[model samples]
Target: MLHTLPHAEADFRALVRKVTMPKPTTTRRLTTEAGAPIADNQNSATAGVGGPLLLQDQHLLEKLARFNRERIPERVVHARGSGAYGYFEVTDDVTGFTRADFLSAVGRRTDLFIRFSTVADNLGGPDAARDPRGFAVKFYTEEGNYDLVGNNTPVFFIKDPLKFPDFIHSQKRDPFTGKQEPDNVWDFWAHSPEATHQITWLMGDRGIPASYRHMNGYGSHTYQWTNAAGEAFFVKYHFKTNQGIRCLDAAQGAELSGKDPNSHQTDLLQSIERGVYPSWTLYVQIMPAAEAADYRFNPFDLTKVWPHADHPLQRVGRLVLDRNPDNVFAEVEQSAFSPNNFVPGIGPSPDKMLQGRLFAYADAHRYRLGVNHTQLPVNAPKATVADNYGRDGLMASNAYDRHAKNYEPNSYSGPAQSDQPLSAPLALTGHTGTHAAPAHAKDDDFFQAGELYRLMSEDEKNRLVANIAGGLAQVSRDDVVEKNLAHFHAADPEYGKRVEAAVHELRED
Candidate 1:
């Protein structure tokens, strides 16, 4: 019964006219990276029509060689991400807190790029999975590329850097099973009670963010900010989204994983493309340098938070993402952020986690992107670098150090050290041998977690219990599950009881 409909002459002519229209012409010709012309790309060079290929085919050799080495190694953590170009504008004068040039004056703007990501997912994995999102910002400031690498949560699981590798390994897939085993995760958590606070937050409603635009971002570690008077203050950054906070329930997140794996990435790109920009108001919790020594909890502990009542937030600036990447891989993937990239007024604190990241991030970039990764356009600093010590490395694109006097302290007009004094030096008097982390007399890991649980609403509490039990139910070892539940019991008896009941019900089913 199927039949072809007759087309009108006008419609047919219009379609033909569109299809046969002359395309724009370009004078550029195809060439290799070395700029050699590729004359016969369709066929390989051969001794005869049907004979063996010739070795002198430079084009063929170059094409194959380049294609073979195209892929770079992925990050050990935070492998999957989406990034956008933006600016950070100082809305309120924060000269009292820090002398950082970007935050020097009201209404001043610094170009920046922000990358949002899932901490434990692979490059092609579902973006909606239950994992902490990495909220890192790289500010192309006048001094240099200052990077504020942080997470969406205000606190982290571990305070020390030594345990980071082991913790990450436990979260990732098991070597034998080739899948993330809950047994391994629970075992680690059960032993490290310091992780209790972060675990509670992770199991709560805000764990799976609705999108990168909806969740709040935090520079979790305590940092030092020096003012014009050279007085230092311990500060923490909080980027509260202008778009109201939103989250996907476990069911919604799981469903979207199957329906649209790249939901977050697509949402971010499309929103920017449509001119619906996303933004966050920057706030900092400043603690007097002297107060850090006498704080109730270890001020630099990544596992703890400075209570808002004690050290209140002060508005500083606004960050707006308005442009999407032209080429995702070239720009977004190549963009690198590190905690060590600090400005003149900003400096590192004694936070153990921050201390480790200062070294690890730069080392990882060197391994994945070669020694001259900073030479890439996406990572190159907007400000001029005066130093001439660095010379040649693999893929070295810039040669500012081409002058014969590449070495420092040379008489031949080489760059001289600045006369300005460096930031105040941190005082250290600890022993050289292995020692436990500095402890405040009243430190107890469960107190904060308990306080957080008591603050949650009834529905949020129920969801938290369900999320925790859901993962615990998958743990094959009953001992591991029981020990983890005990830790939860120490935090809150009701939380433990509810999760226990849920786990039992799941086991029965």
Candidate 2:
């Protein structure tokens, strides 16, 4: 009769049939966090085995206290992400462009870690959602750790940092209903015409990348690269994916979201494990420093891009993700990247968005990963570190300067600032006041958006219109829809008319 029962049910009956409960192994004992042996894990200390629990049970108290505080706060943005270990190899010498030690030689390799993420999602959000992706990289160079914090798109929605918080709030869940409101998103975009170009891209097929490996990466903001001779050049970094670009339309993305929400994360890890390493050829667009002052459009604008016809891409290096992280939490979740972490040759431009990020990124890391976050193995530079500072914080294990004086200019042989000039000084003339960005000679925000719409194929245009109309149809405010349509009409008449008609049809349905 016992044999006739299912295997799992028979096993449970066998256990219950025992004369007494089985004792735990004597060979191994469980310990507390302080490494003290625990006497009885199954029962708490008491006057008797069945009596009321004693108040002096330290083991039980410690276990309960520790269990109550185990989780850290998730990132405010780019919360859903995957990372991998890799090396960036210099394939072509960029000595003429920058004096950085890492890029001096053709075959030199720098250890690196890269993280890919969706912009406006939570930690457990669907990876196939339609949103701009974050492509951030950290290079442990001989000179210090250099972080290229960028997005997949070369251009962003807004030019200034002041609008960033408001823009993000619109994209995130509404405070009232705890759901993403299209009315809020369109209301914000309609008021800010500068967002037209990026909105166009977001509504197009590029919004949903097929996989992280297939999408291109960009150091979206213009940076300054100084050569050995002190000549500065405005440069932009591009990582052209070797796997070729692949995108999913709105329908396909929605289907995958329901079927496999982790499609991107699984694809990247399995690909590297199967020896199909993904690679990207690094390229840079170099512009003479003198030309920036007289450029037709604002060179520092984050909403615009430098046309390829004006300045061509120069091959510099290649980045290959060859290894997966050993521990996802230690390596990927704790990894930090900031624009403030620049090598000697590379520096920031006057772009307002970049300027705000220089401070914001590091500040966020400090809050999220503690003050000594850089000391973590994933973020620490591989080269020699001669840091001198007073520090005692959460997880401050490897203090670089133990016995030495933490103060500068001391009698002790403490490390001093490098005599080499960090960057060339630029002349400043404007007063410190809230003023609008100076307009360039031929600056027009709608021109590029129109050009992009005109460049798309017929099928792409149809899909783009359908995607925009579908999202816009959810918005309840008619005035907001009209304002959004006006911006599109300013960009291209056909683009606006198609979207308007489609949105109206959707409303009728």
Candidate 3:
């Protein structure tokens, strides 16, 4: 209710009392969250002599297996998240730029699932921590599923996807110590100064959002949108919050992290429950397809944003998340969304990270949730599905075809390829180079971070320096501290000086 609330009121409370529900009761009796009936929640159905001799007991095996696989591989990144359901309503005529059905017409309401997450953290980590918030959305439109995976920040740390795994590892806990290593993060940042931009955002006031509802969302990477007329336009999505931008200082964030580890989750859930639906005006910056090649910066680079002056956000729609999931495990936990799951009208750019994710996200889900993950209601397409030939796998529900040919090229007029139900022909001209790791460019990384640092308010800039130094200062080596500060200085002198001061304080201690 809090996700869509007008305000706190007694009438809303009374309505909530009327609808607030109890734990669900299904046809099947009490089972595990994975849906295996619990014959023994009180005690494990052990052997007769309690000697662990019976190998024939299947229930015990089931119990062990269920317990063993309880975790579905916490996301390699964006491990911590809260999700909800709602609708996207087209409010503008964007059909000229992209034929994406969700934006085809006004009053068109498409079901949507949104997952808001902290970029760096385990599933159980503090919600109010100083980190980037992930804003990924999955829209079930008439064509198919469309997943817009993004972050709260408009730009990223690096331009190339080659450094993504390394960047993630630097932020994650050190393998040897099982603790976040300042040395690892600083070393990575010092070497790749492109880290400065994202680092600045991470250490500033916006790092710790007051709540997920109060922050904005960005597509982060530039994308391409095409209309039915076979015309293409470069696009970047921005979800400006109606509630307005709100954030926490370091002390306040620390206090709230301890007091409420699930603060953001609770706030979003509460806001929806109260009918104060949190909304974002969805806007997109559109660029002509012909202009991408001539643009000053590589349009496909992940670490940069097209300046609003050059490609102003043209309002396309409004994204409103108003409903909470009925079952967390079924609806939220099992949900699998990917950037590759695009409908026809919308598509990806040559953005390397986006290209890599096209394969990686679905592959990860296959490992995590088995190949039939999409069969789950949460991830399944509400639009017409022609998956008749998609054969059986684990948890196979409808028998696809008993008589028809599962293999393709049958004379029975089996589901043949449509003229173009799949994708628009995106042109590629550059010489295909070695696929190992793409070449890096002069403007590939650093300048954007420097620009971002220069844009922060005075107080925000100070906090950025202090927050980064407070963590980096503990590195024990002055060389390590100084080395990282040099990268900050390369970003902006003021940025470096303040961080230097904070580091000195720790050195004194």
Per-residue lDDT of model 1, residues 1-509, tens digit only: 11243444555575577568664396777888898776556678775445699999988999899899877888889999999999999999889878888889999999998899999867888999999999999999998889999999999999889999999999998999998888989989988899999999999999999999999999999999988898888999999999999999999999999999999999999999999999999999999788887788898999888889988889999999999989888888887889998888899999989999999999999999988888888898876563547767898766564556767788888777777543445768967986667888556788789889999999999999999989999888888888888888988898888989999899889
Which pairs of residues have clashing backbones in candidate 2? none
> Mind giving the per-residue lDDT tens digits that candidate 3 earns over 143-237?
77889999998877776677888988998999999988888888777777666777777787788899999999998877878778888777889
Ranking of all predicted structures according to lDDT, beginning with the best and ending with the worst = 2, 1, 3
For each of the candidates, the C-alpha root-mean-square deviation to the true structure, in angstroms, is: 7.9, 6.0, 11.4
Model 1: pairs clashing at backbone N, Cα or C within 3 Å: none
Question: Alpha-carbon error at 239 in model 2, in Å?
Answer: 0.6
lDDT of 2 by residue, 202-277 (tens): 8887999999999999999999998899888889999999999999988899899899989999999999999999
TM-score of each: 0.93, 0.92, 0.86
- Model 3 spans > 4 angstroms off: 1-68, 386-388, 421-424, 434-444
Collision count for each candidate, in order: 0, 0, 22
Ten contiguous residues with the weakest lDDT in model 1: 1-10
- Lowest summed lDDT across 10 adjacent residues in model 3 is found at 42-51
Question: Roughly what TM-score does model 3 have, to 2 decimal places?
Answer: 0.86
Please identify model 2 stretches exceeding 4 Å from their true place.
1-30, 38-57, 398-402
State the TM-score for model 2.
0.92
Alpha-carbon runs more than 4 Å astray in model 1: 1-24, 50-52, 419-422
Looking at model 2, how many pairs of residues clash? 0
